[model samples]
Target: MPVITSRDHPLVKQLIKLEGSAQYRKKTGLTLLDGINLIQIYCSILGKPENLIVSESYYEDADNKHFIDIIFGHKPPKITIISNSLFRAISPVKTPIGILALISIPALKEQAYSRKVVFSVLLEAIQDPGNLGSILRSAAAAGVNNIYLSKHCTDAWSPKTLRAGMGAHFFLHIHENSDLKHIAQQFKGTVIATSIQASKNLFEISLVGPTAFIFGNEGAGLSKEMIQAADENIVIPMPGKTESLNAAAAAAICFFEKVRQERDSILSSNIGTK
Candidate 1:
């Protein structure tokens, strides 16, 4: 393994550019994965990364010996050990994890869109990366088959969003910069939108069938075009004086409700069969 000590190293410069600019990542078709957990998930799901960069201190630590051994076990990706200072410069987290991987962005396939999706999420102009990531995490947990983001939404692969998503990205078929209106128009199942003013409560709706839940910006809620495009509009039925739920929180509620409905429906069917 080669050691890098200078901030001006070609790889270091590339990492800096990737970390700061989504455009650079888009141009190069590469993204950065920080921390052991993310790198492990990426390797498990996608295969070997293009490069694995570890800090000299972490590489030398006895506690990390097992992880180092695992990295060496997959010999294709060249590993580079960098000075602690250089590693910190490249890292986006407040507390540096000392390890990062440069990997190609997973390509979205046409087959992904062709599948009969049971549950899906559509986000429009969600500006906060943390909110988007949290929604994705919840979506994955609730067994959402696909996620579509409008063109105005934040970059899903940004470092902040990636950190927020944890390992959920690997489990999802994420389509970013999508046309939400077109998707809504063409969807085979119920297209639901969340609003505070809607007459029907979220729990009152039947989500056992194929469903697509549309969530929008933090302040404005869903666009008029999206609301008009939806098959039905439902509210979360907040009895309290709170004006609104955060986009992420709202999404989680909707997704898990769909999960609960589907699980109960399956149980009912099993009982009838028995």
Candidate 2:
């Protein structure tokens, strides 16, 4: 394994830039997976990476040696070794993971406008990376196959967002820079948005068919245009006197309510057949 001791090494400089700049990442079509779990997910899903980077401070390095020697050494792969200090500089987190992988970002196909029974979520101007990530994870778990992020939302592919998503990004068809109203206009099924002024309750609506849930910014909630775009304006019933829910939490509740409704519908249909 070749060791990179100098800060001037081309790979080090490139990685430092990648960690710091989203524009650079987009330009290069590259992103770094910071920890072992993420690296493992990428490898398991997409086969071997082009390169692996390890820190000198990594304890029990023989495991990596095994991986490199067997799985990664097909073509004299560059599993570059570097000092701990250098790794810390390139890492985004406060505590650096011992190893990382340099790989091309996975390019998933965009979800086309279709009349099919698809479950979707449209996010507008969600600024928090952690919140965005949590929403992605919940969306995947709740069977929302399509996600549309407006142009004003934070970068979905950033390392922080990626970490927050865990491996959920692989499962979702994420569409960015979307037009929410246009999507609502073209949608075949119900378009639902939450509001404080809504007369209807969220639980009363049937999400059995194709449904699109639109959630807005944390502080601003839904804009007037987005609210007008929704086919139904409903409120999540809160008896506890809370003003509102966190965007991510509200999204999860909305998703799982759909899930619960669908499950009950399935049971009802089964029973009716009997």
Among all windows of ten consecutive residues in candidate 2, which has the lowest summed lDDT?
68-77
- Screening candidate 2 with a backbone cut-off below 3 angstroms (N, C-alpha, C), the clashing residue pairs are none
For each candidate, what TM-score against the reference?
Answer: 0.93, 0.89
Candidate 2 local Cα displacement, residue 124, angstroms: 0.6
Q: Candidate 1: what lDDT?
A: 0.86
Candidate 2 C-alpha lDDT tens digits along 1-274: 4668889999999888877787898899888777777776767677766777889867347776675565445563456889888888888877887787788888877657463358989998999988899999999898887899999998788877888888778778888889988988898889999878889998999999889999999888889999999999999999897767888899899999999998899899999999
> Which segments of model 1 are wrong by more than 4 Å?
71-76, 112-117
Top candidate on lDDT is: 1
**Global Cα lDDT for candidate 2:** 0.84
lDDT of 1 at 29: 87
Best by TM-score: 1
